[model samples]
Target: MSSVDATPIGAGAKARGAGGRRPIGLLLVAAPVALVLGLIIWPVALSVFDTLTVHGPQGLEFSLEAYRFFFTDGFSLRNLWLTIRVAAICTVLLLVISLPIALYLRFSETRLAGYIQALALFPLFVPSILLAYALIRTLGPNGTVDTLLVAAGLPKMPTPYLTPWGPIIGLVWDNLPLTLLIVLAGLANVSRASIEAARDVGAGSLTILWHIILPRIRGTLLVAASFVILGLFSAFTLPYLLGPAAPEMMGPFMRRTIIEVDDPVQARTQAVVTFALCAVFALFYVRSVARSRREQTS
Candidate 1:
């Protein structure tokens, strides 16, 4: 009988096993990683390329002229400031409003807790355009708000639509669901025993919340705030329908630059600027999530 080559069988088995794992790993990890990288990197790369390149006497030359336009133009500067202001205001408001509601839901076992939670999430179910239109109908001239006042035989106030406050209100409404969900999730992780123990020791609700609940979920609040800032800074739909034309938010400003003014390069430059500002809040959100996970793991 011919001597069989045992090495071939063993080596073939090893090769098959390794080959199988390679494909599986590629499917499980590599594909999704590639998808995410494409989603993130492509837009950023395009924005940077467009922003930094300009039609020169030669062919295309790299310049910071797009950024310079933003700095030099009064409207662009005001638009940037408006975005920053809106983000800051919305973040603070969400913290104030969502935190208490989250805490209440955390502690409540009443019949209405579910209803309240559902109500808080109502904005998420509604389409943003629909919501924006609803806001316009409520705040526009002789719209629902004024009509209700007229029906009540009261003086109709000036229309608040097409103003900063119109979009601000819409943003607040849209952002509430996300804020509530984050805070509520954080509250879920709080030790019920710890809270009850504090209660047993005669700690008041305010004291328990301030000392216990707040400390426990501070990271989560920061995460929520970061997300709110990111969303509000790059907001498009709400700002488009509701905001004023003079001092546009970054989203509408970039849009108008492209469509109305026919300046795609400038629009992309504004996009890069918006992305840079949002990166700060994105970093904070990442760090907050990392810290929360590390704490949980420990």
Candidate 2:
């Protein structure tokens, strides 16, 4: 009699099933992938091409005149510098404000933790335009804050409204929910046993935090910073409404370049430069994610 086949029927069927599903999976995602390529990738590629090439006496030759002008122009340079500065400050502030809250949410079991978390996430539900108007009413000249100060027999402190600080404050508030969520997710990965063991050895809160918690979440912090910086770099509404008339953030600056100055080339160049800067941070974020995944798998 012929010997029966050694291969298990179930294993063969399973392998065939998986192979069959691959096409279906690809088919399901094909539309979205195509949309992304068509909508986002194509436009960005065209914009970059437009920014790099110009109609010269010799024809459509490559030129950096727009970029050179952006770098050399005093107003453009100031706006770029201000955008960078504001992004840096907001990133730092988000870290400082979010980390502690994340830590508390991660470690605490009290009923108040829920309330605090809800409060932290409240900004997510609020629209940016509404938030901007609320900020104006609450912090603008002779607004709620000034009125309170006057009533309390104290000098009215300088309002952040309509200044560099305005965007900083608005950005920090707008971005807090996302930053806190990222930090909390990072904190979730910390081993409770490790924290408890450190505590058993008489490690104080700060010591444990410094030696244990911060090290574990360093990658997460970098990812959060990358996202915040990227968003702030491209931010328009907050910076436009709240920022100064002169030396505004890149968003308003780009808008004004397009509408007021009517310089599409300059605007495109600025966008390209901004994209390059954001790409650096985006790469960092991707590497951090990849490294974290590798560590988890290994």
Candidate 3:
């Protein structure tokens, strides 16, 4: 009787279970996937294509002229070097400022902690243009900072912030909140148990931080640094607002080619270079994440 009743019921049950998956799952995901491919992936692919072609008043010509021009262009090396320097300095400054705040928030129970965090994040709400204007008021000649410096017997002390260094300061200020938030999130995941155990075993605060906390949050730090680097590369508003008359950034270069020169091809070429830089960073970030995961797993 049992043999007669056996009819591969489990196979049919599995088939029904597979068929019951909500179709909305695919629809929900497909739209975003398609949109990204269409808007971002396709345009990036097209920009690379555009960079390979030469443009004239007459029409487009397929050539290596764009790539050739990039190498021989004025300030190509100088401006590129400046951009990297700005990004590197900003990343380092941001990490230095943010990591301490993040650590404080993680370990301290001060009554003002939440307020301090809120203030830190409040800068994010301020527009870059407004921030630049404010900085100009505070640090410009005859401004509050300069006024205070003169009153403090430090006349002829030019505000280093008025030069390219000024823009870097603004970049750091603008980027600090986001980096702090990310680092704090990573810090929160650190094991209090481990910290306490270290303390119990006669480890000093510095030793515990060096031995455990930094290693645990190294991935977060790398990710934050990557974001800052990419943001600096793509950023235009802050740099343009704060920069001197001869502002030099990849963004301004792209803008000039597109808007002033009426040459989309050159703009596309600059964009391709920026994309390549970002791609290198992205590959590094992916590898860093993979290494972190392997370490955690092992």
Candidate 4:
């Protein structure tokens, strides 16, 4: 009698074994995820809890004092509004400056590509606070820029250092390179064949850019803008060093609340509010990424 193929059964058993090992592989991944969750969840949850309860001069107590302080507190809304405004301004400036540079890097075949990339990232290597100091020395009273202006028969201009504009300028300088890098990476994935096709179809450069490149890279643009917004919003060093005597950032205020005012609870509240605002933007960014991936796959 001819034996039915036992070899087929053996092959099927091997395939089943491979499939069974996948769970073990997944279990391995879960360990690091669990570690991260363990580290992050507690602090975040505690802050949220703290935001609900009150810690009066007497001690910690269950009350809405923190939120009350945030809402009824003078200048809180003004500072929050200013923070949002600054973030919006920084996002616009970053995009306007970085996008054209990114496009040039992607479309140009010049050898200066390496030089340009290095130059773009050079600011990133410098620390924010250090950059602030450097800017001050170059543009502050009797600084290089002022001396140059005087030599050129121009009056010495007032230094912008340690002012509202100081932090804004510093934030842009610090974050511009990173924004450019992200946009450039996105532009790299634009289909060259598709661009050429558009050109063949009598599409002008502007039309091709407007229709083909922008739509394809919209996700990247959003991601870059989100990063700039979040970075500027949470910025500490540059704003602390370069901004006015009382900068309107949650960072500086949180420090004052905690250290100078000796109110840990208020500081925690500010931290949570700032984090929550940024978290909302982060969630949108993640959603955009997911949608972009789905579109690409479909």
Among all candidates shown, the one with the greatest TM-score: 2
User: What lDDT tens digits, residue by residue, belong to model 1 across residues 259-292?
Assistant: 9999888888888888888898888876776665
Question: In candidate 2, how many Å is residue 29 off?
Answer: 2.7
Which residue pairs does candidate 1 place in steric collision? none
lDDT of 3 by residue, 1-298 (tens): 0011111234344344456587665555566668889999999998888888667777977888887887787756566666777788888999999998888877878889878888888889999889888988887668898788878998745764446777888899899888887788778668899999999999998999899899888777887788778889987876776765354677666787799989887788878888888888877666776676577569
How do the predictions measure up, each by TM-score? 0.86, 0.92, 0.85, 0.86
lDDT of each: 0.82, 0.87, 0.77, 0.79
| Candidate 2 lDDT, 1-298, residue by residue in tens | 0022212234444445556756765565567668989998998899899988989899899988788888899998999999999999999999999999988888889999989999999999998889888999999889899999999999988989889999899999999998898888888878899999999999999999999999998998998999899999999999999889988999999999899999898888999899999999999987887687678669
lDDT: which candidate is best? 2
Runs in model 4 deviating more than 4 A are: 1-24, 55-62
Could you tell me which residue pairs clash in candidate 2? none
In terms of lDDT, model 1 sits at 0.82
* lDDT score for residue 30 of model 4: 62
- For model 4, what is the C-alpha lDDT against the true structure? 0.79
- Reference-based TM-score, model 3: 0.85
**Candidate 1 stretches greater than 4 Å from native:** 1-23, 55-60, 150-153
**Candidate 1's TM-score:** 0.86
lDDT of 4 at 17: 49
